[model samples]
Target: MNGADAQSPVIVVGAGLAGLTCALDLVRAGLPVRVLEAADEVGGRVRTDRRDGFLLDRGFQVFNTSYPQVKRRIELPRLRLRPFTPGVLIHTAEGGRIRFTDPTRRPSDALALLTGKQDGKPGTGPGPLALAALGPLCALDLLAPPRLLKRLPELTTREELARWRVPDRVVDGFLRPFLAGVFLEDDLDTSSRMFHLTWRSMLRGTLTLPADGMGAVPRQLAEGLPPGCVERASPVAALSAAGVTFADGSAADARAVVVATDAAAARSLVPGLPAVATRTVTTYHHAATRSPLREPTLLLDARRRILNTCVLTEVAPTYSADGRALISTSVLGTDAPGREAALREVLAELYATGTRDWERVGTTTVAGALPAMVPPWPLSRTGRTASGVYVCGDHRATGSVQGAMASGTRTARELLADLRRP
Candidate 1:
């Protein structure tokens, strides 16, 4: 390892959102910073692929516009975001569909909602009253003051739902599928705090996808940084207060080091860190001549075989070539043998269409898509590990893009404060 002066730049490992955010903040603070990423690209999990004239994200992911960090950093208009419908369409176990919409967004629908009609159509689903009843309850809980939610005792998400008086029909038919798609778990065992925060964000903002793809988010973040600030394909094998040793036998001296890798990678780099459980997800992309669902609404399965599915082309035409449709389906788990075939069969049933001609474009299986968030989880944590050595990622906060970026910002502030110390 080469020796260096104490004035060397701050080194950030892993060019994911956390690392990139940290580097950006440090640079803006007038501190020299360098970012090292193992992959050729900056986005760790947030990546887009162009295949056969289609834009496919690394996994099925969306950008929530309500994230404070995202709102502060991202240029929404520049991203050319396309929004999903205000609410979700739940395919009930009894072979009917329920379109649940946000009444606040569609005031006209509120009247229909009270009369057991959805979108001016009579409800033809299992337990229409139950579905209608869920609307007011959800709105009440979602619109509850942030201070009130914060003051409530921590509980599992399931318990929180009961406290909110959400009925079993809504829980099984709507919340189960929707939350499974978000949390990647059907049990609703995630933290109630997380659920409330996430739900509030959803109520306050729209769920959207960029016209170019999710990768555009990280690409935008990296674009604003100075040239040579980020070194791609340079992975750090070990980190210490003194500096970092790269896997390529190269070394860099830094006054401080920040490990911003994923939960598993962070643990590998820094021993004795708390172990975090992660949720896996598998997404399958298929090309169809026409969209099964013409609307841009997300569809959930009440029967619970598939987590959720959406027609990307319907939401953003840029996602697919002209005259072709792109369907993205996500399941909660890793890919298995014959999984694709099974998913195809399930999709056919869900959409009530024949899938014999639908072409399978790609399948992405992410083993550690998100860190499992249980109750009593910290919204933020001290990034300082040992003096000049620090760590930050989604694991340090909630497991979302917002959480990741927030952790990075928090780490940068902490590091800056420490640097200013005598």
Candidate 2:
């Protein structure tokens, strides 16, 4: 590298996936870089905490292998990801447990969910016709090109489902609750494009978690960078021509500054950035004596009492402490009066076990769990800012693991091209 390049390293604010990725790309391209993080560790919103030998992610999240960016950026085997059952179990208000399996993923289990005859029960499910319709819908989303999906008229997810003629029973009993957890909104107002892309990834990918925790994702990314590149506990205050001002009254000079925080933080850090509305979600972790239902598949409340619940330890034994099962349940908003009590009550009904003895390990409430995507949305962006600074995150593009890393990659290339322009 030139003497000038050596002196002025690129400064990256926020050591989340996007920031870590941007720094890694630039470092690999022979540029000196520094990453500043407000928090003590990486992963931003995608973080995990350890309590009593249990791994509690900030919220319920899974690593999707089918996300193009995930496959390209993350080393799957290194994570030792464990997949959930390719389906979900719905606990109806009527006290019946219904299973919905994705036939495309496991054809052998097709007969169960496809015909609505699980465990020799005829009327326990949504019926053959309605459930059968799902495969084609998922297949369409799985195979359709992004360009083609973008060309379609903009619509809310509810509208798109109506256009496809999905049965009300299937939607209300299953999709509605399932998607509430996915989009973090109960109304299904998320963009059809975003919904389709999310659904496509779910259909084509294995829903799994890293054995360590979600935080391990960003940790792996940060590890790839040169030592001392990421400076933790370093909060960036402002971006200036000389580079960045830290919250502690310190400053760092740089050739360029990139903001890679979450949507809210990014907007606060970079003035006049495009506004991205977001949704809130909270996850509660509880410890139980044994696994509930003996499967790692998500169990949804048909009554919508809780977004979804699962035995985390069933998916990964190491997530538990003292050989107890770890159960996690999420709801659509921040805390409220009697919310924890309500969560426990619903957990008992859903799991058919008394939660009186289960211990509440941790509760994580995320203000902006996901950006509210409404059409006409740009699935991807250039990460260019009007203030002459660079910005990248899930908020800049579609909200997902893919968007964060892809935005980081895009911003790095943009910065590299600018540096090369004589």
Candidate 3:
């Protein structure tokens, strides 16, 4: 088994976004690579289904134009990005609505949005911090690793919002709702490192989605790979410097291997990967007889508990077949059995709809849907890199499609560099 023989072929495990993207990029760079997917298909967390002529995503998810890695790596035309309206309507238990908008794209304005209040007004009002955070949000090119690392251990999200004089009530009501939708946490319980980075990105990019569904992004990458590059449903049970073996007893000799699955799965596949924390989210997809509103998307900020109602139809009109709306209430930390009841109570309080109106078109409860993305985020959770092994996934970065891609690319790049070393 020499360098040109079967002994040293590069093997990438887990055909999720990161794995697929990493494998594709490496092959494009003139390196030979093979991808193994545990499931019958690719796109691990990004599962999309076409139901009765309507596209339904497995869980509630969305992306923004500001994702630097995704923008650089993905072909935009293939996925078709749809922008989210600038404003998000907040529906309350009293059947009252308050709409929040950012007036500036600069940091100061973004900072201002932090402190502004609802003033008992519904729609068309600027919160305090919305104005101050403008510059920071719009300047994400300046907000990457080095720049962000400077503000750590001190300039936290809570601290930054407080510095802008964001009113307590508004932070509880407005900022919390926005953050919850993004981080999938109720309060600002997530780490400041993650929140600050996210805030900067949101300020830089506009919210966008694919016309097909979230899965389309992963699907496009998978299709671009060489025909034999991917082997579906071949779960690798173990790996060594000499070769790899699958659950069915088939094996392939490889000089290098990369594990790009979820954190939990990675721990089992690799020898010394750390444990990854988990969080839960419940997504309620109801086809309202009427529309949730004429608007396609709204972000509701209730008390510190339930986060927001994401109106999917507003972002992409094709989600609903009969013009019936698809309103997804995304609740984090909510269990499967209790999610339906919780959503009903919240919706009835917010939209004035009774149990009768929310006719339950569909519901999905994703436990560990999103890894508990708090600070001290386990960067080393990806398995230990021994003689011929590497690791990559959203867990290796932030829990996002782009994060996954970036990690995978990093792994492949590292492996290639190692192979070329003298």
Candidate 4:
């Protein structure tokens, strides 16, 4: 099964999180690896740009400290992680702005979860059903054994939530809108298993950002490898079991090839792809002279046109070079060049502050942002294809840092095991 020749390097066709992890693992196992990246820098979709004096991430991304791969690979102290309020702010016509804190973690927020006082005032809580369901729901996700959880029948997230007896209003108002941002699917059609996994992580981890930006995450991962292991601005024109031809009429021979690019790119590189369905996400970054919603909490739209918006500067002051407030908002689909005026109107309502003077710093649309995890979704799949080569990315597993790195790790382990066999 090993297609590689002796002393030939394993050529990785991307320098994304999955690629970085795979190459790093390979190098650790005493294999020569060369990472080819089409972009000028590493990180692929997980990139940051300095523009208009703002640190704008390519998409709205957060670093969860609790991811196993992240904890094992990244040095938390180096990133200087900044935490967001472990709760959400739901903005709706019905309830202007409702805050829900994780009373379990933040005892200082210190009231009943639904009945908890927010912004230092008596707040109206949820009805009896939601109040009763909330704690046990989180507890089950948090405390249940992983093997037991996975054995449950696969269902759509919405269906599973209903089975748990979450009232329809709660699903529509909060769960749907909030999860839409996370899963990049507004319908909650993602797998219940994926939903529970994420819910458990959220309960256990702190939602955070690197002081510098999300880009630092992959940069940190790549830093461990030897110098020149990763080659930037190198695009792969075609792939074969023997080697890869570059877009520039050059070729590099290899023992094996790993297609670690996104799902679309992987399809072009490796044929007969898995059942991939993805949702696109577009994030709009606006710079404002005046701060809005000064707290470092994510604002979810219950009305649900814009999935969520946050004051980036509130979480990490380094995100803004000129100290102007950086507001980032994300929508469920792609390309909204014409929606500037309307987006501003939504921001105006959400923040209760006019966005007329806010400058649009950047618009980032990540096609295939997340793999669509419909009912009966496979939590993980074999990356080895019939073609004898391999593929790895978030799409090969679930979509998250954990998923991407785990895919890379699993593929590397598989590849290494094959090589070791007599």
Could you estimate the TM-score for every candidate? 0.93, 0.95, 0.85, 0.96
**What's the lDDT for all of these models?**
0.85, 0.85, 0.68, 0.86
Candidate 2, residues 357-400, lDDT tens digits: the string is 98889888999888888777888898778887899998888888
lDDT of 3: 0.68
User: Residue 399 CA error for candidate 4 (Å)?
Assistant: 0.4
- Highest lDDT model number: 4
lDDT rank, highest first? 4, 2, 1, 3
**lDDT tens digits, residue span 1-422, model 3:** 12335335578888888898788878887777889888887888887777755677767877677777778877887777777766566654344456556555434333323433244444433444444444453354244663554356644456656765666656655677777777777646666666666666666667777988888888888888888889898899877546678988878877677788877787787776667787777676776766655665566855644656766777887777777667777777655666587667767666655645655666666666666666556432332365347888888877766577778877777777766777
- For model 2 the local lDDT of residue 87 reads 88
Give residue 326's error in model 4 in angstroms: 0.2
Per-candidate clashes come to 0, 0, 42, 1
Pick out the ten consecutive residues of candidate 3 with the lowest summed lDDT. Answer: 108-117
**Lowest-lDDT window of 10 residues in candidate 4?**
109-118
Give the C-alpha miss distance for residue 43 in model 2, angstroms: 0.9
**Residues 1-422, model 1: lDDT tens digits:** 11446478988998889989998999999988899999998889888989999999988899999888999999999999999989888776766667767777977655544444555566544354666556664575578986676666789888977877777867876788999999999999998888888888888888999999999999899988999999999988887546988897777789788899988888888877888899999999999997899999899898899989999999999998766999999998888899988888889988989988999999998878888988778777999874347899988988889999999999999989988877
lDDT (Cα, 0-100) at 166 in candidate 2: 92
Where model 1 places Cα greater than 4 Å from the true spot, the runs are: 1-4, 108-148
